[model samples]
Target: MSLNGPRGSAWAMTERTARDVDRAKHHFSVGPSAMRWDGETLVIDIAEVSSPLPYKVRGTIRVRPEMIGSTAFSLDPEGRHRWHPVAPRAHVEVSMTDPGLRWSGAGYFDSNFGDEALEDGFNDWHWSRAHLRNDVAVLYEGKRRDGTPFDLALRLDRMGNWHDIEQPAPVRLPRSAWMIERLTRADRGFIPRVAKTWVDAPFYARSKLSTRLFGENVEAVHESLSLNRFRSTIVQGMLPFRMPRAIWR
Candidate 1:
């Protein structure tokens, strides 16, 4: 899914998959999305989407590693789940050909892998990424299923320095239309406000917001996920409407 509310545009598409999925190493292709590491960079390609909204959307974004290191941390105490920001602050070049979608600028890339489904390991979580002048800061805070809470604060600088920073205070933002509470960590006196509601659903939401962090006022990508709500029958029933998928050849 992608959104540009400032330009009055948004899109979402999903492709169904079989029960058994290929577990290839560092490479996979399914439906409209595919990725493979080419030694120097991670290449991602997306084909034209035709669901949720009919539009020809496609692009290839390469995430090249920089001198600054990445972040790899475990989410659970048992090490069942882990997250990695391979290229926290990478130069993104976009060549997407679409009617109302074309952009090329700085972007972020990350991945998550776990031993079990998220619903079985987590209840809710708030994630935010702030791109600064010479560094990129990210925050991860959430509650584990076993009632354990974890908060991580990390910053990667351009000179290959990775350090742990103090956790900024939680800046509360207004709830979404779905009544999902939104909050993010920011520096002192750094007010954060949602600039756009890219995607808001019963159990998930993604937004772009502004905040002061790393001594700069930066726009951050924020997301909130509620595994408890996602496991509900009502949300599952409504999922087809937003993520309807057909067999892909």
Candidate 2:
């Protein structure tokens, strides 16, 4: 779990064994946090202590899907990886006690499934999502381990319909503070700018982008992942400091 805001920042990634995990038709849990789907909304309960800081992070996030997605897109040619935008358009309600914050706004929920390790599948990837007037535009592009490239552009409407669209030209954004390469897509002749960077690590970067998508000016949440850097020994050695492991008794 991670929270970044003006109040403060907190991060907790506790690794646990299989004995600490629970799953059912509509619920999944690990350690002290869990996510359950009610009839209309997905509720997430978080109880965690930040790593390296030990600050409490307790919150409830409710995501109400305006429309549920029905399809999953393959990220690799051999069907080794797949991406599903479960709730491309949604309303989010956040209430946090440890930070004493409350807010609501447009939100999105998605999941990725893979048959093998991520580094074995691809080198890196860039993804972004923008909420248009009555639709959501998502762009995904990446390079495979075999030196092949794949990309997807889709527009999901408020009525649970998906339409394939032409991908926009790639735009190079300023590198992150960690010097990680960042990229996003925007309409022709329009340049995208990074409004805020949320997470900047050795192997990953997440930012808020001001860009034009589908001919509309919008602010998009963008992320870039470098599997090459992630599989390096230096980054591997640094993981223990950020993600503490514990056996749930």
Lowest lDDT sum, 10 consecutive residues, model 1, at 15-24
CA lDDT, candidate 2, residue 69 = 93
lDDT of 1 at 219: 92
lDDT (tens digit, per residue) of candidate 1 on 112-149? 99899999999889999887787888888988888888
* Deviation (Å) of 118 in candidate 2: 1.1
Compared with the true structure, the alpha-carbon lDDT of candidate 2 equals 0.90
Encode model 2's per-residue lDDT on 1-81: one tens digit a residue.
767888777788888888889999999999899999998999999998877677888999999999899999889878899
- The runs of at least 3 residues in candidate 2 whose Cα sits more than 4 Å from the true structure, single-residue gaps closed, are 246-249
